[model samples]
Target: MPRVPKIIPISDLRQDASGVIKRVSASREPLFITQRGRAAAVMVSMKEYEQTQHELEILRLLARGERDIEASVGFNLEAVLADADALLAEQQ
Candidate 1:
């Protein structure tokens, strides 16, 4: 079963902006904001927003790696793994 999205009108948001923000932050769920009975924007907690940005950056890096592979440009896999191991050991 699909879960229903949390939707709210702009006026409701305006009337209880603080409460709405609290609910979104506590629930860690997105709140859909509608204007003129149409979709306008989506609100998410700061942590969620930051996490999404981080994930997107990782995806971008993976895509870049793929492109590099296609162009036959990359470091040796074993050397890279060894470097990664050394970096991890330094933190420990």
Candidate 2:
């Protein structure tokens, strides 16, 4: 299971932004920011944020590939280029 992050209110963030920032930077886990009793935003170190974004992009690409496979829509690079060349020759 994924670990739950520590939640902080926006007010606390405003009052001691520097300290909160320091805490987040020093910790491995991300911090959750709440506003009006609802989840508003997330706070993570730059390295962690970049890593998470990269992982999400990879997941998205994997999902798209899986969908294409399930729908029987795939690629044959060599065959495609050969067909393209033949078409071009015919046109010429």
Candidate 3:
């Protein structure tokens, strides 16, 4: 599991937004921002943000694998049949 960074409330951010931004910008980790005691947003350095986005994309791709199988997107019947024939020939 990925590590969760420190959480900051929006009210505290209003007091010193620059400092908070600077701190989060300097640190590669993400800062969770909460609204009404619920997680509302996240602040992270540009590199970290991009990395998070890439990870999410990979997760999305993996999640779609099952759907791809259901859709029979890349099923090669001829290739499968040839391989099965070869296997049976070898067994014989």
TM-score of 2: 0.66
Tens-digit lDDT string for candidate 1 (1-92): 98799999999999999999999999999999999999999999999999999999999999999999999999999999999999999999
TM-score of candidate 3 relative to the true fold: 0.56
- In model 1, which regions exceed 4 Å deviation? 78-92
- CA lDDT of every candidate: 0.98, 0.92, 0.88
List TM-scores for all candidates, in order.
0.83, 0.66, 0.56
17-57 per-residue lDDT for model 3 (tens digits): 99998898888767889999999998888888888899999
Candidate that beats the other on TM-score, 2 or 3, i.e. the better one? 2
> Could you tell me the lDDT of residue 66 within candidate 1?
97
What lDDT does candidate 1 reach at residue 27?
Answer: 95
RMSD of 3: 8.0
Q: What is the C-alpha RMSD of each candidate to the true structure, in Å?
A: 3.4, 5.6, 8.0
